[model samples]
Target chain A: MIRGLRKWAVPFAALLVLAGCGYDDTTVPKPEAVVTTPAVPTTPVKCDNKLQSYAPSDNRGAAIANLANKGRLVVGVSGDTLRLGSRNPETGKIEGFDIAFAQRVADELGVPMVVRVISAADRIGLLEKGEIDMVARNMTVNCDRWSKVAFSAVYYNATQKVLVRADAEKDYKGPQSLSGKRVCAPTSSTSVDNIKAIQPDVVAVLALKHTGCLVKFQNGDVDAITGDDTVLAGLAAQDPYAVVPKQGKLTDEPYGIAVNKGDVALARFINSVLDEMRSDGSWKDTYDEWLKPYLLVDATPPTPVYGR
Target chain B: MSQTATPQAAPPPAAAATAPAPAPAVAAKPTPGLVDTPALLNRWQLIGMTTAILFGVFSALIQFGGWQADGRAADDTEQLVRVQEIQSSLLRADALATNAFLVGGLEEPEQRKEYDDALESVLRQIANAAEAQPADREVLATLNVDVTAYATAVAQARDNNRQGFPIGAEYLSGASTELRADALPILDALVKANTDRAENAMAGQHPFWLLVLGIVALVALVWLNRELAQHFKRRINKGLAIAAAIVLVVTVVTAFAALLRDNSNDSLREGELATAVSEANARTAANDAKANESLRLINRGSGEGFEDLWSVSAKEVEKFASRDTRSGWDAYVAQHNEIVELDRAGKWDEAVEIATKEAGGSTESLDAFDQLSQQIVTANGTQATDDLRSGRVVALVLSGLTLLLGVAAAVAVSRGIGERRREFA
Candidate 1:
């Protein structure tokens, strides 16, 4: 028996070696860092009155002809900004303060309204490209945008402000309180530059939209979020922990409806609609319904300025 | 002649006494030193036996190594397919989740269940992969953490969406971004590592080495036969001849078997294995494209970025799609192009309608392509692994038989040399 075992030793040893075969531990490759281009600063164009627009006219025929799509009024608006222009989950319709204005313009033109959701950065580019007839998203009139796109008269006077965690609300006095803290704002918005100008030391982060900033604030990625008071109000209503404390405005963000630079007739038509909303007292009523509870202030529509 | 007398002869003593007065002419040719014939025969027998036995051991070992390599190749192929399945499943889950979000807060129940099922498959497969391959355990562990984080974020997004919060979109977007950044690279590494291991293991058949070993053994046996024949006055030693014959037969047979196995492995690596890997890639790309479609709608008018991403993923699908899946992919592409046209024409509602509809939509075509590609991957992957494993048992048995044959040849050598010794005595 011993001899027989000895005779089978080589095969048995080979089997043992085969059984013990193993590989080196596998390794995971490190993820490559995502590269993003920093926003470039351009020379600001100078203009006397950025809030100026073509004088109001009831030339609905010319404005309808200027529509990119013949039968429908394609208006770009925000789908994520809650009180201004956002989708309602139950109704599956985008209805808010800004959307109401767009709907009125479409109604007055005797056309169907097509709401196109867009980001803050694409507001001017989409207008210039003739993709939308007008942008009723809470876009501000500024000298830089005035060179690229035409705006209707200022309809709402908004002010930029900062929102902080509710626990940090007591210490927040103004932009100075956010010094040396991370603050998030929508990319391409004037609010980031406004906050940075005031404190000069606040680290400004950017998101695709205001709600995106709220997400960052909730995730503790940023200590505060800065945007228009109305936009901040919408963001604050979503999170109980977030609060926009009583603070002075960083800048007067005069809201306007942006149209293509060459679409002066459409600009005139939008102003006409805004004028009607103001005369009919519907503008104040819409404000009371949407912005009153959260803003805690009675407001009136900004007087439309024209003569461009 | 008297000095050269055999030691076994009785006359050697008398001859030793009488032959001393012999003539010394030409310095009397020196008598060849006495050879211990038995010792020489014993030495030749030992050399011959050892050569045959060693040939058996080494050749059998080579064959055994080949057999083991096939088994390992099968295992590696299985692991490769498993990692790829995890990749596809994760993307499939993302596609379902993103598509469901297009319907607002109240998502379709079936769609939600599909998303859940896909995610569950990913988690379960990760665990299975870790258990199957010890080498991949660490990466799979990290992957598990990333997947859990993604799931948590999606859950938050869903809860918020149900309550009509716009921040829910942000949550979903962040989750998708994190999944691609954190989880995908690990999966890529696993795919690469297993691909290399499987290919390397498949190439393990060494027909050249087997041939070389056989030739060297044959040469040694032939030389031993020559040495024995020089003394025994025969051109061939029967025992050595038999051993050489055994060596030749075993070399031809085992070498041929190894060559056949090598060719089979090559075929499998290029055919079924390639199909499985490429089809799996196509499936993953298809799912990625579908997710980008939903994301474009989610982002609404500013979704040009997502549209560009969709184009890229669609191109990837086109590049990797097999003939079997091309028709389904083509149908999906046509539908996708129609949606893009409608979106560009500012008919977003119409585009969303076509995109979100249940039947005759881009979703249905893409689903068909995904399912077909998945089936192809499973079938071809199983075939490749099975082919590698099927005849391994026969290979093992052949290896053992070669060893026994070697020993038999060694015994034949001993007996044949023993006959020469007996004749001399």
Candidate 2:
């Protein structure tokens, strides 16, 4: 019995030993792949300025009555633009020339004011959408925009110009000197389109917001920034190195309060409010409070141009 | 009679080898019985010894090949998943910070809540990963500090922005740069390292030695049964037959289980891991793009850098974007283009409005990005867990079953042999 068991054990042990060894090669894991994305350029809208005017409508219309009935004039204004409609950080309230104008309109209408913070792109859309009663956001009055939205008579006159490094202000005096140089401006605004139209050779860098252009200039990324003189002054005030050249007032940008296209009564009422502010010294006082220090020059308010 | 008696006393060497032992050695006259010498052991001893050795070898194969190897793979996969979680959360947190900064001073309640949630998740995931990967401890420590600094910078910026201070823009820029430069890169590196480890574990060569052992045992059982038949002159030996049958079944089961493990590991290494990495990278790019959009607004620079960043990152996101997320990305890109157009036209106020508006502007795009990113993370996470779990369960169950079958085969062999031995006794 022992011999028989020994014979079987030897073969079984040999099988076990043989089964314990063979070929194994380690496979290296594949590396991760990286993705690459490319940038696409934007196409800006062309300015179509064709100004319109209307005679004063009798009595408040449905739109004006609706707003009056609501007891609060819902007006859109910028909370970022320095002198026009900037927020007072201390008070946590928007207080500027635009806000002052909105308040005056609301007072004349005998309605409490409801200020809705808005962006340059939002002014017309909100007005058209009936989301707001009026847009007093330092909006430029132009012929093209007049086709889509009604505007009050021009209350403030600003000039389009270039803001450059203080030292380069003299060198880049006007649109003519900006040829072949990189200029930054906000998108969906007339400024970039105007730059493209007038200074075709200037490379236009479009920012999502106008403030973005200011930062770019500070970073030395752009040769100059072009916009309304008021906005340029605001940008200049923020940066000690930047200056709006006194000589280069590029174009006239008459500030107007935009309303819905067919709201003739609301347009007339807003126009009357502007006329009152202009004659009553309130407009001058508001301007002096917010913009005088930045202009560094004595100025008279622009005369209103109205026709029936 | 005289010759026979002489032979029994002292036989020729060759003839004596074939003869039985002398009767005097038995202690008494032998009863009539077939020879059962020590050299030719009882059937019970043969069956018990062969089956026990075979069963032991089979058990070793199952433990080493199926259980241990698979356990290691599962562990590696779990580590990789943790890395992914940390990375995804970090990206989301960075995006939230940028969003809050753009809102300017006292971030919108919704955005703040999201930011807080993302940060909390990141902190938790980092802790979990650190426990398993000691090397991650150092990175996690640095991340904690960086996140704190980022939060401080965001707070300072918010304060300045609330007060209408231009310095707020600079603060926001600083915070965004910190996230892009410090936190994100470290998270990415940790993910890469863990991914590599998982790949190595999953794609490793299976235990071919186990297969060899199983095959060898099956052959040995068959050979033993054949020998039993020839020696015993029986058509079949129930003990050896039963043992051989059980080994065959076990061998088949082991092979099938091995195949399942091989296929699962292959899919994980080749398909799932790659998809996970792609999805993660795309999501990161999308978030980076969104943050850049906010930066552009806060800084309001006319520089093309922000726009360029948006374009590239959006494209990267689109490459892996599913149908559900594609439109969101598309809408965002379209809205961004409009905002750019407005900004370029000297309509700074209008551009700001579109970019920062609460509805129907850039916010819509951001919402889409958020949805897509969450979806990708969720899908990849589920897939990773399922793949590893399935493979592990198969290995574990097969390992246990293989062991049980081996033991049963040995016992059956021993009992069959015992019955035969009893008949002889």
Please give the RMSD to the true structure for each candidate, in Å. Answer: 5.3, 13.6
* Complex DockQ, candidate 2: 0.04
lDDT of the candidates, in the order given: 0.87, 0.67
What docking tier does model 2 reach? incorrect
Q: Which predicted model would earn the best lDDT?
A: 1
Q: What tens-digit string does per-residue lDDT give for candidate 1 at B1-425?
A: 11111222222223246565556562233334745576667777777777777888878888988888899899999999999999999999988888888877589899999999999999999999999999999999999999999999899889888999888888888888888888988988999999998998899888898889889989988888787788888888787788889989999999999999999999999999999999999998899898899888887766889989999998889888999999999999999999888877767777877788899999889889999999999999999999999999989998999888888788777777877776777
List ranges where model 1 is wrong by over 4 Å: A1-21, A31-40, A68-70, B1-47, B414-425
The residue-by-residue lDDT of candidate 1 on A177-227, one tens digit each, is 888899999888888888787799999898889988988898899999998
- Per-residue lDDT of candidate 2, residues B151-247 (tens digit): 7777766666766755455566767777767776676666666666667666543545456666677676666666656656666668667766777
By DockQ thresholds, what CAPRI class is model 1? acceptable
